[model samples]
Target: MDLSTLMLLCVFAFTAGLVDAIAGGGGLIQTPAALVLLPQYPVATIIATIKLPSFTGTGLAIGQYIRRVRLHFPTAVLMCITAFGAAFAGSALLTMVSSRFMKPVIFFILAGVAVYTYTKKNFGEHTTKPYSRKKQLWYAFLISLVIGFYDGFIGPGAGSFLILAFIALLGYDFLHASANAKLVNMATNSGSIALFLLKGTILWSVALPMAVCNGLGGIIGARLAIAKGNHFIRLFFLCIVTATLLRLAYDVFVKN
Candidate 1:
């Protein structure tokens, strides 16, 4: 890429990192920035480049969260393994599934999720009873498996979906849900990174700088979210869901 374009990409990565750190939808920003800047490259290459920044950002955010809030280790571990395995399997079968056919349905689901959260009073504001360990494990495993597969096969809103699943199905409050979502998202990104590596789709030059920018953004965002607590997360989650829904609508209906 040209110097000007490269700089633009870095800026986008920085912004993407900040958004992702707060609300879990950085791809909604960084991926499009890659497409706009590196129009000549394969989509996969653009995506891989974003990964470098995303992983770095996630690592930073994880550290930030670890310092302030204790992560649920068992949930994190199970989700990661399931997500990793599922993403691998999904990547292997990527060619078989067509995202266009699925996009409308995904959009509708996201719409419902967004609406439900908006309308429900106290919807993700308070921690409810912890599900039985076995139940939580099962839900987390299934969610990771299905959502992880989606991340590898056709990626969009993977983080948002993971957060939504944890909140609605597993009954986590927004703060814990966001925290748990990162662990799962990190796995999803790792899975996508490995597959993109196998396919040789990553543009390392772009990815490296963007990764640093995105990492910085993640660190700042995660720290702020941790400091603010659940009320802030719930509000931010609604904002992200709205943005995600709009993105899906444009992609599925307007652009397509």
Candidate 2:
């Protein structure tokens, strides 16, 4: 890549990491940037390239969140384990299934999340454990499995979906939900990156520089989110999910 192209990708990666650290839709930015900037590459190569920066950014964000927010280690560990396995399974299945079919399904689901969150007014504001410990573990595992598979299969809004599930189903506040989401996101990214590495699909030269910028942006964004607190996160989550919903709707309806 030329210096100009590399610079532009770095800028996008920085912005993507910031948005992703705050609200979980960073791929919504980076993927489109990759498509436009590196159109010559195969889709798998583009995704692999994208994952390198994302993994680095998410790792940094996880560190920041862990320092500021209290996490449930048992649930987070279980989710991470299931998420890694499910992500690998999903990536393997991608060779057989058509990811196009998932677009509409995801659009509708994101739409529901937007609506439910909007109408509830105070959803995800306070941490309230509505379920028993066993039930919470069961729910977290299920969410990680499904969303992790989706992350590997289709690759957009998975973090947002995970955060939403944690808030809505698992009765976590947005801050804690986001913290947990980061851990699982890192695991899922690692799973996908492992497969891409095995296949030799990643564009390492482009991804490494982008990863540095992404990590820088992630650190700043995670600190901001931590300082600002849950209300800020809730608002940002709504905006990112809405943007993701619109983007997916365009892809499924207009672009298709």
TM-scores, one per candidate: 0.95, 0.97
Off by over 4 Å in 2: none
Please report how far candidate 1 places residue 202 from its true position, in Å: 1.2
Superposed Cα RMSD, model 2: 1.1
RMSD each, Å: 1.5, 1.1
Per-residue lDDT tens digits for candidate 1, residues 140-224, read: 8999999999987767778888878877887777777777777877888888788778888788888888888888889988988
What digit string (tens of lDDT, one per residue) describes model 2 on residues 1-256?
Answer: 6999989999999999998998799999988998899988988899888898999999999899988798889988999999998888888788568799889988998899999988888888776776789999999999999999999889778989998988878888888888899899998998888888888999999999999999998898899899998889988999999999999999999998
Q: What is the C-alpha lDDT of each candidate?
A: 0.81, 0.90
Model 2 residue pairs with clashes = none
